[model samples]
Target: MSHKPTTVAELGEFTVLIDVRSPAEFALDHIPGAINCPVLDDEERRVVGTTYVQVSAFEARKIGGAMVARNIARHLDEQFRDKPRDWRPLVYCWRGGMRSGSFVNWLRLVGWDAQQLKGGYKAWRAHVIEQIAQRAPALDLRVLCGPTGSAKTRVLQALAAQGEQVLDLEDLAAHRGSVLGAVPGRPQPSQKAFETQLAHRLAALDPARRVWVEAESRRIGRITVPEPLLQRLRESPVVEIAAPPDARLAYLLRDYAWLGDDRPALADKLDGLRELLPRDVLAQWREWALAGALAPLFEALMARHYDPLYARSQGRHLAGLPNAHRVASDDLSDAGIQSLAGHIASLP
Candidate 1:
């Protein structure tokens, strides 16, 4: 109990982070690298909360205390039985109050250094927001701009391979940032979790070197870019990769070919364009998708749907993009991308 509270700065490779919050809470978001060893499981937490509000705090504690003790004992027997004496760990709950404090006391009695996060997950969330706000504005960010299917993400991967700092927001969010952006089986993280992931990546980047990121709208799938980072990105210098319509379409066929495998899924996603295009145009695209005519349909989409949206978004949000230095390619092939990446790496 005498162990002082801890901050993120003091955590090390060996420091174990235990999130004592309920599993449901942890799923929405928790500190990165933290493990869930809840003192109260989801249903038990609900029952205890109902008791506190409807019955009384005393009765709730009387009921919850037993559950907490049993769960703690189980953890002690299973998760902590092999721990050495010098093991120091950080434990946190939503507010660093009852849940984490109770767990800390038990660990202290067992002779391990168990420090509570000063203000728990709430504090950690505040830290993420603050760090992004404070550091984002100062970033030497270079936005890689191109219309859809221009292989911007590929270029970014190449840049990273060449040891340049790169941030792939789509990769962090686990989505491609479009109507058809969802990966076939993988789902995007909760907004909070996505932000937490983004914050962690941002923290690791050095501000001195140019950090490259793809140009994206504020919303990527369901993940909203942090405001500070988005603002800085919008204002940063742009480097557009200009691929021909045929090259982009060829690239789209390769990239989005999976959509043709599930006609229903493709049909459903194409339905998202209903408001944007004429019914006849939408019908033709839907027909093409259902009929497995991917190349023609993808071409139509770029010409009618994606290209126009990209143009407007670039003009409205990325003010400097009209004069952005262009990197043209007749091909978006592996070699072409590598060449483009090499040219970009030489930029001042």
Candidate 2:
């Protein structure tokens, strides 16, 4: 029946992590495996907030307390009804304030070993950032280098499937790290959420082992890779996937077939590169996109944009890229990618 707050480092598999923030707050970011059981839902929180600001403090507490009590009761009945007496759940709120403390108090009264998270979600976020800063420098990160359309992600997936340790940043970021990198329909998570997920993933791996990751700049879409981790990635040795231009083009055409179905969206994405390319050049790309000339457009982008960008970036930033151990292949098919992965995995 102790009410001590548990530190983030003290987290274990046996204890459940419950987030008692509003649904909107939880949506922005929470602990990696936390379940949302908000003490005050979105509207209730807003109403209580407005009351606190405009009405008397006593009035807001009276209103919020009643709402919190009712919500806590609902959760106890619907969510925690079947829990065993010994079940330990770590509960948190925005800043480990009254909301989570109230819920933890209720659960403790129920004779369960429920504890409040020390400093709540904010503390957890700080811990994640610190962990990355401390951990990234010591890891043996192996970068998989390739230009755009090189299918580095797919090959990295193959390498992962072959039982290699991989850190798939693009998958975590929900982006391909390009102007047109957004996955259709699936939106990216907030930057905090992305970093939390990355830190959690990194925590699970043995940093002593060689961790395979795709080469990327510090930024991916709207999300930026944590600077400490990005520094390690930039400094890592590279294993280049030297696929021919034709193979890369063919692979991109198949992989990005959806872009062909939505020409308007494709054209808009092209417009993002306006500052880099001339207006006339962009106009031609727009024309190519609208006419569904996606293949030629893909080639034009690779030749005029992605390839040159990769060349400069690698030469300037990637210390291990020039002497990268090359795995040359003319095949960009799934099986071919698998073969490339196997070869890379077998490297000393």
Ten contiguous residues with the weakest lDDT in model 1: 6-15
> Per-candidate TM vs. native?
0.97, 0.96
Residues 1-348 of candidate 2: C-alpha lDDT, one tens digit per residue: 666878888878346899999999999998878899988999999999999999888999999999999999999999889998889999999888999999999998889988888898889999989989988898899999988888899988998899999999999999999988999877899999998998888888897799999988888999999999888988889898888899999999989989999898899999899999999999999999999999999999999999999888888888898789998988889888888889999998
lDDT of each: 0.90, 0.90
| TM-score, candidate number 1 | 0.97
Q: Which residue pairs come into collision in candidate 2?
A: none
* Segments of candidate 1 deviating more than 4 angstroms: none
Measured on C-alpha atoms, candidate 2 has an lDDT of 0.90
Task: Compose the digit string of candidate 1's lDDT tens values, residues 191-310.
Answer: 989888888888899989999999989898988998999999999999999888999988888888899899867877999989898999988888888898998888888888899999
Off by over 4 Å in 2: none
